[model samples]
Target chain A: MEHGTTEPGTAGPENQAVPDRPTPTPAPGTPAPGAPSSGAPAPVAPATGAAEEEHRPSPREQERERFRRSRRRRDTWIAALSTLAFLGLLAAAAVASPGWDRVHGLFLDAGEFRAALPEILQGFWLNVRMFLVAEALILVLGLAVALVRVTRAPGLQPLRLAATVYVDVFRGVPTLLLVFLVGFGLPALRLQGTPSQPWVLGVIALVLSYTAYVAEVLRAGLESVHPAQRNAARALGLSGSQTLRHVVLPQAVRNVLPPLLNDFIALQKDTALVAVLGPLEALRVAQIKADYDFNYTPYLGAALLFIAVTVPLTRVADRLQRRAAQRTRAEAAR
Target chain B: MNEPLLRIRGLHKRYGSRTVLRSVDLDVAEHEVVCLIGGSGSGKSTLLRCVDLLDVVDDGTVHLGGTELTDPRLDADVARRRIGVVFQAYNLFPHLSVLDNITLAPRIVHGVPRRQAEETARGLLARLGLADKERDHPDRLSGGQQQRAAIARALATEPELLLLDEITSALDPELVGEVLDVVADLKQRGMTILMATHEMGFARQVADRVCFLEDGVIREEGTAEQVLTDPRHPSTRRFLSRVLDRR
Candidate 1:
């Protein structure tokens, strides 16, 4: 750490603090470490306009730089140690069987993997449709149930309890059991014509199961709305329903968007559960291709398809979350 | 002169085992401003809520402008429309723009046309010194601005009685003056305000009558000058002393 010096773009310690600094190049003809003037410590302040490019450091900033150096060294050592361990494991696995060579051969053929893409993506589109429909149903049903639960009306208590029990039972049961129950048990009960198709049953199952979880999300969202909002609306002579529709639901919905998007992503992946009911979703397509071709390339193709959809959606959600956080921070600063 | 704007008789409320309001009685003359002041948990808010039918009294009669508000047989909704309330927290809807927040109730509750409601909302916003903020959400406004917008929202219906419950309590020290100033402006314009406030200075300056509540009952009631400057009740003196010492 050293005393202050003028630097045009640099902010003082009290203002505009940031974590990183790019290294500035030293001037030409600077003395090396063991040169004639190196015996004494360097003087910080000089006569007016002497190069004016020497870096100034405060005591705290100097300590921080030293700490940063040590931490970087520690991280570098950890990375090197982990890399060595991974190489050793790879060597061991390779020696155990027809190993690293096979793995390399499996991954290096990009052409074979790319050929199966059209078939995999066809199934993946159907999976997307199933996810969207299920998520829409879940969101609407969840919001209605959450609203009923928060209502002050005594008559809605039974309805609210029924919704709660429904959410608990559906969420508590495994998604596979739900798909099976809808696909197999519904036909046995003679509830529908030929139990519908497996894809339909899968969608129904996902909607039912996910709605329970989404309802809790909506409940939390509704709870996040301040009570004064409701009170203010009521003071304006609005009815209970009007107050909820006008004042509570809109804000609650915005607060719940990120989590709701996350649920949609989860539902997208979980659509593979349709395989249990016997439709070809992305995973099922991968399975069929693997079974027919007797190769792992088709499965990899399907994995990439799933990643393409999910990764972009996650990025969008992340951007929205950051914007929301920034808005909150700005409001706090105000 | 036919009936008082608000009248409460034999009002009672209890929370679990502890009684909060015990047979409270009060009346507000036509277009009169009444201030209810008390220590915490003294039930001023509860009594005020009961008058608006926001809370139902155990055994009481609450009449607003000659219509019985707490009567089980009457249209409580209609009675409620005649009274507007402002809470301590401003309570503006965060999702809606300032214009929408002010107009939402009129359009939804009273079946006012959107165009007419918007016009009325703009007028109220202008009156509240928020004409330029109609497009902004509540989060964009300062605490004082939000409270003022909330007051405009409550007044959009032209309610016969305005109930304000600690309207400035949630404001920042710098913001409190702006909110209290609005309240003072309202008082001067002869708005029939029933406020439960901790602002002793504002109460002394504006309130027509001050009622001191303790243990769910009015311990003392008098003109603002007499009640604030020359309190006869020991509890009132104790309360004033504590509040004054802090200042």
Candidate 2:
């Protein structure tokens, strides 16, 4: 059936239109965007018939609006209180500590502490390189593992089982332990050589360890797509692969992005875990600089570095979660 | 008058040790709408699934047009593409907008171009009264809109036959009317529709023929008025009484 539309004035009293014969009248009674009500007299039959059918807001829609208003109220309170409390904490901590004076000097003067913004920035670039490379590897490997685990092919069972076991072992074991094993244990096995730089070794270790956990996260997201979605695609005559490509994977990945972003923020913190491998990630730079200065300024600097990296990532995660939540609630109300 | 568009014979299915559908026989003429009504677990849905080839029947033959679909020499994949099945659950792909859900099958399976399919999908969505929801995902749609989208999704394939497994049962009471209105529209359009439904009133209103299944067997079959209002078999009367008592 083609979508039929009627001219705007066709349904007016003087131009009363025939109803039920596929007259395109903008679906009777639908509020057209930005329409100025001309007080046009209502049509006689067809328009009135459709008006009776389609104009009312469904009960589900009514319930959804109620739900949204209640959630808005609750979220407003949470937002206001958290902001005030955080500001209060910052003020109290600043008042209790005059140690910030020395910390300020360390940042401004390169001569006194042997620590300058340029040197720290060089380390920051290295960290950025490491994260980008690791994330690329993580996405590809994790997606492959996720697909392997979710596929229905019989011969792939062993591969799927192995992926599951691998995910379980890696996720259960401490990331710190896994990174150590990658950096140090491979040399004992005589299978590979450790990279020359501690930073290089740290990147490899972090990537290897995190990839295992990320793969499982990806699998969970893939599985979150409802079975009905797959069935609907199949009913449409799509091949199994086509169904996955067009219907299943797109939604699964969208549903999982919030969690994936959460994982990314955790990944930033996990980069600090590379400190054990001796890469001059933010934490390692702070510790090395603190040793030279005989002061805790480097340690405080590391905390600030993490806050800088994490705050923006968390905001993105928050936005994703809010959208995901609103969608979920709307769907539930339906 | 016309040769049947669909024919089912000696259909039998089992799950583990439990027999869900016994040997059953049925047929549907081209452009005819047949409604299957029975109590829960009566195998009406299972029969629809088998006909659509969504489930591999343990043993049976489903003939589409003139082709024997379940024969060992026949390809199940090709058989499936010829039949479109709408589930009771209205499984609209949650990620795709309503329009995408309708367009995807035609584009991917039938090899229709994206632009043509989009136009067709937009047409169907609008006809189903979901024009405003074209950009909204399934999760954002009401039960009726979602079911209508499911219907549009099935029709997008241009399948000769449509298998509806209680598509309106999952809807809220107020929403059932809209979904049934779509079904009525399809019926009036001369689409071949075989529906398994719990909506006895809608079944009476739309079905050309109504079949009653009991204990996985077709207990009775007759004209809609004959079967729904004046059933002759004692078992059919008992079933009708039970259905009416609930209302």
Candidate 3:
């Protein structure tokens, strides 16, 4: 996880392409010298090595290559057309259902979708702002907790214990339950300094719940670095904190980027949970529209909005994991 | 010698019930090179780690320039500022470029200005024949080049004494000589060094004194010619013969 986690297309895209071994693409039906094939095929001397031998591929070989290319092209067309056809038929079946007209009128009405779009989109902006603030706070606070937990300093013992307790207690509490507590419990006390805004309480709850999880992820990342690395840094005269900032944390954050991004995705979706605390977020807007017109198209619109943000985040998370694996797998060659 | 730069007396280290170093005592004077020659599990590395204050000593005292590095009351980090170490495997920070690796300690710990640190790092890199590798990450370099860069990073602080723990042990045969040549070059510049090595040939050529360690204790100590050529201990003889036989 230490720098092995590749946040792709962010840095110079080319270097990340093959951070380790630039896998030499397989030769056409022959073992190529310098390819260093991981599969370890027989080390066949290059056909071009001997001037006396005909450099041209044999007729049978040419025939096989042409067949392979044609088959691959056929497979692509078949897969694409079949996929579209299957999806089209599934949709057609849905439209052809016995209660199709009522279902469409309630759930797929373009007029309702169009009318709800403006309010839902506006409410989604609240959701976006809530998560953005929560995510920023979670990143900083989570790292602070992780660093505290990872340290063995005598002076930090109290802090380390508190951080551990905080993680255990808050992480165990359901995020929704925590949101309810912050939104209702604080106001019930009527503390002078307590936040009055529902959205603020929602953010605070999200921060607390996610910080515990992110801290654990970060701690795992910090621990994943080899002990020798710590020794190397300490031997160089860096203090514990300096070693962490300069040596350990960078690698740790890099290692846990995929999981961290995954958490952010969860946090983004959870932002809609704040609607329970009375914010005019997407979920609440959808609920209001559905109640008013007895139509659910606005709910579908809300779902689509969440999917719009999450699908890309999920894709980024997947790419990060795959790239990290590739980087480690290519480590030996590097 | 006016005063030995690094002095160790009765150093002992143990991991749980297994003792790794047993009452080890050694010293390196200014501008001298001392080689600890032994087989695996002989505690050459443990002894080096203890001197660098990397390991918590079970029992011992290590003084670097009169500061008791092993003293619990002392600041080990400050003591480490005067001591440089290069590991068996090049442990250059992978996230850092070669220049950044070299400059990290100088700038962060020593409070050297970033520009000054970079200047010093480039000078060290250029001297180590890696002038053009400033922008390259550690993994981008070959084993030999990476080891050399690690050495440059160790020397960036201009440490008073350098500790090398089998720096060439991980290198391929073809790559070992380049790193050894760099060590030799450092010696010529009057840098004090204490190193563990399996390279008897290189040790013989450069070590002012050789200490043979066996079973967590220093079994023999003398000039390289006396200890290596005219062995006083049977284990040392056997070890050297086995090493030479392989070559």
Candidate 4:
């Protein structure tokens, strides 16, 4: 109690002469020392100056703080220990399986995978080329369809209806069926100008199927823009096409960028379906090698190649999605 | 009076059997400031919107500066270029800078050169007290600053008539004064204005003529002093009293 009184006197010379500041510090330090001498005025000064400086917590507050700290430490240890135990149990179970030797011989043959790597890499280049060409076509086709579907002009109603039907029909049909139909049916037509190349037909089929899904995603973004914005643009004397080209499309594309990337990723994976037409894509090459060696490890090599390309793209899309969400929240707060 | 700057006769508007404006007629002389005052559903906003051709009239004619504006054969975009409109909530394009919002119409619709349009936009921005905010987006501005920028955008085209629909209704109490001051300045410059407002005091102070709308019609019309201080209609008195009581 004496040290508490002396500490305040040393901390501030003005407090020693004030009589009010020194009285309160000592009363809390030694509450049972004397009530009438210190307790009466002590409560009033501290209550008013509570916010001015940090004070020692009461026993109840100290106990609550200690409980919270220990609970946080316990939660961290429980989570970490449970994750380690789960992984260990899985590994132990895998080692003790009766079919481990046979499964390893077929699927995990490291020598067979290494032997197939060079040819799989060469075949993967074809898949990449198809993906790049199809992606460009999909962007243009999808944007055109979305623009037509969103048009409000009375004269364009027929075009809008046609675009709607195209999207519905294409999205309903599977990509593999589209590839088969375009690859086989176009050649069967025997049209003079149509190319009979399977890869070209494969690219067209991928674009046709993916454009429908991407257009719907873009249309959702366009519709989310408030109608007030359209009214403002119209009131400013901007024509419908000018408004769409400048105001509406920029905002719409920005809003739906992550979803557009997701569709492109799906397109990349679906390029493998082109193999049904006898193209030497990564998957087809892997299947041939696996059948020759009587081992499934080449399939694993093809899967790894696909994963290597897609994982970076997936990470980029996730980062962009997070940033867009953050920007939306900040705009809302403003 | 040298042909009214704007004329509306037999204007009718309805939304699926619910009539909003029924055979409304109004006239505004050049350089005159007319204010429309009404209750929530009194069709003040609808009448202004119809005059601007933002909403199509069921049956009517609107003439601006001796040119018929309601003809269905006329290109609405070309016609809209001659008029300026400011809305409640200050609908400034959120994605563009203040200067770009002001210059978009003149550069795109009127075919003004980019540098010339930007010069005019900068002058308007300076006059509106937003000289330093030319490059700032709408979300970065206060409500009053955004409304002032909206006014600058509307004035950039040098329109024959300006339509303002409750411009100060969306502003904070302190911010409302700055927006009203811009309107007062526009009136001083003799811009032809047809505005709808809920601010009774401002309407009385700045308007040359005031029209009281009630249930899809103008119930009373006169000079601002006459309609606001000594009304001829009982509904006008009731509406004013309710508005004044809240103040």
Candidate 5:
């Protein structure tokens, strides 16, 4: 929000190198380094010259600075008051409704919430455990599938076909359908080594479903890296495998971290879908408590727990996306 | 009088229906610098890629010393080990610091010890005037600085022949001088380099011999002063005037 001042190295080697010629006027459209880098307000001309350092503010300039300060404060106050008014109006409308007393007793009772907390928290650990296992397997399998899809090796064709088919099938089927298929369907087959535990079956189904999505995310990342990067690595005498390992995958993974985190957040929430099986996760526990008391407050407790974990992950993902954008913009400016 | 460090015989390359290079023959003598010059789509970059074994030539043979690099059975990776290439875009691995970018092939592909790789990388960086920027990533450096770091990287493996594909084309006009200066310095060190360039001025100054490519063929080849200023081929003269007129 301030006028430009940060172009310290005014006389770069380029200027020094061309001592015989005055600095070529930057090609027609190139922005001056002193040009405002962002959309923030700039009330003064570029501060490249030393005259701006010593010049005293005129009466008009002093008045403008005062105006800018007061305008910023007023903007902040307007934002805060508008948000508060919106939330207050929503709360007042809800409390003033005709069914407020019955709805409040059924869904917002503190005693029902307290009674449900212990069992729900205990069952929530199962959801956490299932997702953690599923997430790890998903990451490894996703990367494997991505590698298979991107590799140009002749010998891996059959393997690539299999990977492609796996991704197509899993991604085409819905996750909850996959959960049902693996949980109820797998057990019905009565096959040897089929996990008897619902949570284990849930994790497997979660892995299969999430791996498909993550694989596509990772494959896009791998393909997003420029072909020139691969040529550069190979030209450096690196084998194709070495190039993929060192140069290609590192850049691909960095490029896709935000999307990867997004998939992880979805996987974390989808863990609750395991409640369809016999295992008592937080959602199932809440279902049981609500059925027993004819009160819905326990469902709120389960929702709050899921939100508690996912919100932090959402924030982290947003931060990562912002950092990636800033990095690309900075590179483009250079 | 003596065998050249690199020899290309009847080199031909094609991309599906389009022939990018045709019957191209060139050589780089030991300690010599050869520059390829032409307009865009003139096959200059493809020739460099084929010579470096980054692109598989459709026909003919490339010899590095006594090794037939273009032989069907040849391990391309092994052949590539003895040749260094810097692309026009200065493809320094963005994820790595300048030091790591330089040391990657040395420490990983060539199996040099980490300590020794880093030492040699630092030396190359210092030589290329990027010593202080070794810890910075590619995006953190200017185009000229990144190109310098890329040159440092190509030299880390101590390749016998260096292939440069219009290394300064992507730089700002002002930044071009710095990259060209690095090439000139490498020429001074007696490196056998085959380069493609758009800068007729720099090519004339640094290249011992220049080859002009047109329509997938070499139309002219001679000393830089002879080919650039006094061309025998009409195509070469026309290309030269078009390029040299703007600057």
Candidate 6:
């Protein structure tokens, strides 16, 4: 999906700019001097020297400046053209559709959207609460599992195997199925002391599935730490646990922050999945309103709310990843 | 004269089928600087690692002040606390500020109070000419400054013996002098040290004794003047001539 968007966005500029290069200054290989050819050999040296002095900026610098200017112009044209093309396609599709007005009435009616907002907003609060609880639980569980997987002690083999198995099974099972099993199947058994609330069960399933993925991310981060750091920690007389706590885990956590945030963003969207159990979360509220009013505007409203919550979070993750890359580059340069 | 601060008797180290150290025996007295000179892959680093109990030796023994360090029953962490080591590269923790790197061992390993550890760390940093860089991370420092910070960290715990394994080998030629100057300063302060290096000039200048190692064995050992200037073994003579000729 990313490749599809970026390819045309960049290719348009290059294609438009290429023809302009060869037309002007066609003999790029030849260096032109303003020296008049003289029959006398002595004047040749002085004339060429004078010609060289007359060239204010070096040819290479001049060409580079020209290239920069052309590139800027090409970028501007690409942006304008791509925007026009995209809007034109949408307009053409709207004009060609046989039921455009009916589709618009069903999906874009402002009155239906306004009527759905209050209940959907209330439902979104439940999603927010569940996401918060699930995120915290997942972080703790993920770090514990990652630590167990990375520990090298022979005595902890059984514990390591169990943690590994937990990760594998949870990661392999579709989250939707796990949600169904935990939220619906478990409560059907009528076990004593079991909390049968849909929201609680949904949060449990989300935490279980996310912990497996986040644990693998954390494990990769732990493995990425240089062996020298561990050697230095051990040589300083720190015990294995102390070395991990003080030396390894801090660096690993920093390395994995972007991915962990990505996982949280996914969890935020997945909060809507609780509607499968008939809980009146945002999506469920939207579904009921759409069915009652016979308008899809409520579904669009719910989607917009999800986007509003996730976009800023994604931007934050991007900034963090950029900063991390910059730090590594600076370290390498040093 | 005094009981040797570190002793290795018939130390044998192997990785799978290949032996890195073969029946190597050496002793380092208190306040003495012993330099190990050899070509690459000649067991210099392996011997130093074995002494620090970083590497489990296949056979033989390592003793620190007459206590057996290599015994299987001994706790390696307790033995390692008495020995400080600086590697060729990435010696300082990049995640930590210079001061934190220096004080980590003292505070965590020795159970020193935070205030005392910071005090010692600041003094060491000042002595190493990095007093103003205490708050800076290792990545922000130049290679020379990073190495100096690493040395200060190694010295912060005041270990009984310091092991430096090719510490200057990874440094640029211009930066090598500053790190060697720190080692020379440590020697003047009478720190017991065992170092491995290819820098013959620095070794000749700073080492009290020099041992020439060839194929995991000590071919010649004596004072710096005798071993470096006039070696008895044919292999040592050839190695030194080749090294000097390249210079």
Per model, the share of native interface contacts recovered reads 0.55, 0.55, 0.62, 0.50, 0.70, 0.50
lDDT, candidate 2, residue A202?
69
Give the number of the best model, judged by TM-score. 5
Total backbone collisions, model 3: 1
Give candidate 5 misplaced runs (Cα > 4 Å).
A1-63, A331-334
Q: Which residue ranges in model 1 land beyond 4 Å of their true spot? A: A1-98, A105-108, A152-158, A189-195, A320-334
Q: What is the lDDT of residue A210 in candidate 2?
A: 79
lDDT minimum window of 10 residues, candidate 1 chain A: A1-10
Put down candidate 2 lDDT per residue, B1-247, tens digits, no spaces: 7779999999998888888888899999999999998889999989988887777889888888989877868766677888888898887777678887788777777788999999998888789877777887665455677788888888888889999999878866777887888889999999999999988898899999999998889989999999999998888899899989989
Question: Quick one: best lDDT, which candidate?
Answer: 3
Cα lDDT tens digits for candidate 3, A144-247:
99989998889999999999999999999999999999999978998889989999999999999999999999999999887888899998999988998899
* Residue A58 lDDT (model 6): 41
lDDT of each candidate versus the true structure: 0.79, 0.77, 0.87, 0.85, 0.87, 0.85
* lDDT (tens digit, per residue) of candidate 5 on A1-334: 1112223232254222222211223334433444335444544533454434434444444554565566668778999999999999999999999999999999998999999999999999999999889999999999999999998789999999999999999999999999999999998999888888999999999999999999999999999899989999999989888999999999898989999999999999999999998699999999999999999999999999999999999999999998877766665555
Write the number of the candidate with greater TM-score, choosing between 3 and 5.
5
Clashing pairs in 4: none
Candidate 3 reaches a DockQ of 0.54
Off by over 4 Å in 6: A1-74, A329-334
| lDDT tens per residue, model 6, B1-247 | 8778888889888988998888988989999999999999999998988888778999998899989998889998888888899998846887899999988989988999999999999999999888988998876566777888899989898998999999988777777888999999999999999999999988899899999998888889999988989899999999999999998
List per-model TM-scores for chain B: 0.97, 0.97, 0.98, 0.98, 0.98, 0.98
Candidate 4 CAPRI-style tier? acceptable
DockQ for all candidate structures vs. native: 0.28, 0.29, 0.54, 0.28, 0.57, 0.32
| Clashing residue pairs for model 3 | A1-A255
* Candidate 6: pairs in clash: none
CA RMSD, predictions in order: 8.4, 9.4, 5.5, 10.1, 5.5, 9.0
Candidate 5 at residue A137, lDDT?
A: 93
TM-score: which is higher, 5 or 6? 5
- Superposition error at A297 for model 3 (Å): 0.5
lDDT, residue B138, model 2:
65
Clashing pairs in model 5, backbone N/Cα/C closer than 3 A: none
Write candidate 1's Cα lDDT for B44-122 as tens digits: 8998788888777888788877777777987666777888889887778877899988888788878899999999999
Expressed as tens digits, the lDDT of each residue in B7-101 for candidate 3 is 88998889999998889888889999999999999999989888888888999888888888888988989989999999998888988899999
